[model samples]
Target: MKQYNIAIEGLDNGSFQQQGCDTVLRAALRAGIGFPYECNSGGCGSCKYEVVSGEVENLWPEAPAVTERDRRKGRLLACQCRATSDLVIRMRPQPEAVPVIAPRRMPARLLEVREVTHDLREFRFGTETPASFLPGQYAMFALPGVSSPRAYSMSNTASGGREWHVQVRRVPNGKATEVLFEKLRPGDELEIDGPYGLAYLREDAPRDIVCVAGGSGLAPMVSIARGASQAGLLKDRHLHFFYGARTPRDVCGESFLRELPEFGERIHYHPVVSMPGEGENAWRGETGFVHELLRRRMAERMSECEFYFAGPPPMTNALQEMLMLEHRVPFAQIHFDRFF
Candidate 1:
């Protein structure tokens, strides 16, 4: 129950208290400081900072985002280190990265589980506190016996209630998915800390919205679409939703998006299969990667819209390349938080 003070080198009144063993990034974010970060799992290297003066415990020394040069330069990932004592760190902070609803850990109980696909399920949880988050934000779940928390995007819009929904795909032999798919049941208790990530819908933007999702990445995209419709943004802006799955059996976006009130005209849904197997004639839909479909459909309009996407690294990387490198879309127009 001890707390340590964390000081930012140059910013005025830029200091926050770290409670217990929380990471530097979480504590700073919890305090409303917009410290730069993306994955929060140490995958994006966006939270790199220099420890001006402090002793911290490295949580993941071999994190993929940390390179040899970063170590040599005394740079550490804020998400992967815990302050052992009062600390002084230096990093550029962006005011735009601050969260509208700061994160706090709370107890939650699983209320329902519905099957979305053979390997995917939708979980409904009731939390101790009202669920509040932007459409595309994600939460970190501390399962009963898992050593580390797993992050999953929320699939439901914030309704000022206690219910939170997330669609999860069962990962083969994944620790968190094993517990969620096999052992977790209704009434199970766990801890959830969230409303994190910066990829939420930007209602102020005048451009059209393009959402590209693959596999379980469909969760946040659903949230964005629903939120936009609810906020009347879809009335003026079109929402083009692109979903990619391995086969027809994996397709679920059609059903999910249909539930939205704005599914009819303004909402355009496109489902593509990446690998439908040989002689899979029963599946009649677009084939090839989702990014390809996005490029083909959007064409030159890609630069005239706002994009939100989530999926495996490969899919996200592909979208990033196609949008930024190929179409020359402004980096600010595309939103996503990297996670591995």
Candidate 2:
């Protein structure tokens, strides 16, 4: 078998590598390069990748993962391919490890609940057992009769690997938040499992940070900023956050915004509104798509910074594309969690 050197555009080092024209999606993962994917079956093209090098064997001839355009362009689903030869492929780059937590279902009592906005709430839970998690991780709150799992990010800093503060947005008809707002009371016993997702601040890589959050996506970012503020972990890096909301009432954790630098002297906060009221005439900020705002500004810093994104799936998708395509950020530098 002939061997060919594979060079990734932004990846600096190559260690254990996967070679072949059609290496399975699992192959890259096994090689220490984990690509975000779901439903590894061909039906879910999450493993979509483009071949940039040597040829590979196609194991699944009829694999539905390859699209007509993708196939034409030499893009193949990693799971459907079998390495016929040495190869180099291009797929979405992975982000710095943001801390994946194993959620434990524990009974918690509501210690305190604060209204960060008209509809946004920050609930602090004290469990009989220490609920440990990273700052930007999440917890799943399961209702008594409801089968769905509602994931909420911890808005507080990680401390002693115990306790957490979760931020929740009250959707108009959200079953979980509705129950939280209407049925739950402080000191009430609640089923909570938490410390999930990848949204933490990387301690080893001190690159400048740019965090964008929409609606409730601010939870994880808030947790991150709060963590930075408390211990100054992000002390040397320039940290900036862009939070977009409908109106002033949608803005939560204003205090953090007010005293950003006090946390590390390298942090800044910018809040924007898509639609403001006559009374909010004093509001001074850009107004439009958050991605557009990011595109227009932050061009120079895009290359040297790390981006953390959370919120609606559309927002994350748009931000991901904008950061990669427009802002020219390597996929590895962009971190995100999708709220579907």
Model number with the top lDDT: 1
Q: Indicate which candidate wins on TM-score.
A: 1
- Worst 10 contiguous positions by lDDT, candidate 2: 14-23
Question: lDDT of candidate 1 vs native?
Answer: 0.90
Determine which window of 10 residues in candidate 1 has minimal summed lDDT: 275-284
Separate clash counts for every candidate: 0, 6
Instruction: Report each candidate's C-alpha RMSD, comma-separated, in the order given.
Output: 1.3, 9.6
Off by over 4 Å in 2: 1-101, 257-264, 279-282
Query: Per-residue lDDT of 217-236 in model 2, one digit per residue for the tens?
Result: 88788877766666665656
What RMSD does model 2 have?
Answer: 9.6
Off by over 4 Å in 1: 280-282
Question: lDDT tens digits, residues 105-182, model 1?
Answer: 989999999999999999999987789899999998888789778888999887788988999998888889989988
RMSD of 1: 1.3
Which pairs clash in the backbone of model 1? none
